[model samples]
Target: MRNNRAAPPWAHRWALPAMVLVTVFFVAPFLLNVRFAFSSWTSFRAEITWNGLENFGTLIDQDLLANAVTVTVLYAVLCMAIQNTVSLSLALALQRTSRINTIFRSAFFLPTLISPLAAGYIWRGLLAPDGAVNSFLGIEWAWLGEPSTALLVVAFIDAWKWSGLITLVYIAGLNSIPRSLLESATVDGAGPWTRFRRVVFPMLAPALTFNVAVTLVGALSAYDVIAATTGGGPGDHTRALNVVMRQQWGQGFFGSASALGFTVTLLVIATAVPLVWWLRRREVAG
Candidate 1:
């Protein structure tokens, strides 16, 4: 009953080292942070005290958490929707290889190369009253100065910066489809829209899964952009969960911030699991 196949030599050689590295770098620190999440601090980051549900209780009492959750959900949803749609559309438009397509592809992808901090600052200036956007439009609406528009503005900026990467992912997916299948569809009297609907869209599920997951993670992890642009204002209207965590950390609420971070991690995992599963099912079904 004990028939055994020998493992590869490389696996035996490297597995222990890899496990050791992971435990040292990731597992150890993660356990330490989990400990921090349940522990309390006194004075200005002075002394540590173990507290049972006190931090969670504090988070519940802080009404900002509710606002942060709402804003973060809205922000993540908008980013996911707008970025995925625009990117997929653009990828479809530029699927074929050509000089024009190449040029546009580079241009579209340029924004993703910029640091988020720089992008935030760039958008901040553009949204200012006397900035280029207002100057070009001949209107003086303060984009980041009002709670009504600030969250939307930040969400849009986040989408604009990241959609290029999503587009490229979609393009890769599009490129993977065989020309023969598309030609056959055309020969069989399939219109452009019909072919895309029946063939292109379904096959792009992998890209959709990847893009959705990445953008969801990116949108949730948004911090430097908010820090540089709004600093969780127009009166905390644009404050995402990560921004709230950072602010909490700054105010020396380490346990509360850790709890918020853990919540965010759980939320991302929950959303991503369902999304990836749904898209993958579509792939198989299609």
Candidate 2:
């Protein structure tokens, strides 16, 4: 008879190290920061006092807070929709075997390899008043200024830079579909759209879930690009929740920033949980 170990003994060895690292790096700092959110920092020693929910109440009463929430939601929805749609379309277009497909796929993914911050900086130069975009169009438009275009410009940039990454993910999902199922659908006289709707789409739900969730998170957390481009606006027109939180930090309102941080974290988890539940429910139902 062969003797089997009860679970892997090595798991116990790694558990302690993992817990220690997480505590040292993540959990401890997060708790400390949350404490800061409730306390004030002065010139003397780092003093932390219990301030109840004053920070949160103050944030809620600010106009900037309202604008930040609205803009953040708009950006998240638009960017996720556009990025996912365009990316999946491109992935579908490139799924075939051809020299053009290979070349196109490489071109599509190239933008994603560059850091988001770097891309924002590069775009800052190109979208300036006399930059190439407006120059080519023969009109001087404020890509980063003016309330009308500031948020739109940032949203567009977010979509352009990140769409390709989601495209690759979709491509992986597409490729994993069994060719036999597709062929069988074809033989049954199902049209291309029909096959995609009834068969291909369902199989890609997991990938779609992943892509959309990440895109939403990225959009909500957009700071570097907006900061690099318009510095949060012609006049805070494009300010997101993250931007507001950072401004609080800059003002040495650590307690307020920490409160905002916790708020944002909760908001993210709140949105993600419902989305994941719905997607999983549908996946199961179908």
Model 1 gets an lDDT of: 0.84
**Please, what's the RMSD in Å of model 1?**
2.5
- List where candidate 1 sits over 4 angstroms from the true fold: 1-5, 16-18, 42-50
TM-score of 1: 0.91
Candidate 2, 78-186: lDDT as tens digits: 7888899899999888987689898998899888888778888888788888999989999998778878888877887888898888998999899988999999999
Every candidate's lDDT: 0.84, 0.82
- Tens digits of per-residue lDDT, candidate 1, 1-286, equal 7645877677777789989999999888777667766778633766777787777778779777788878888888887888898899899888888999999999999999988888899999999989999999999988998888888888888888888888889999999988899999999999999999988888888888899888987787777778889988988798888988887888888888877787677678888889888888878998
- Point to the candidate with the largest lDDT: 1
Clashes of each: 0, 1
Model 2 gets an lDDT of 0.82
Q: Tell how far residue 232 is off in model 2, in angstroms.
A: 0.9
Off by over 4 Å in 2: 1-7, 40-45
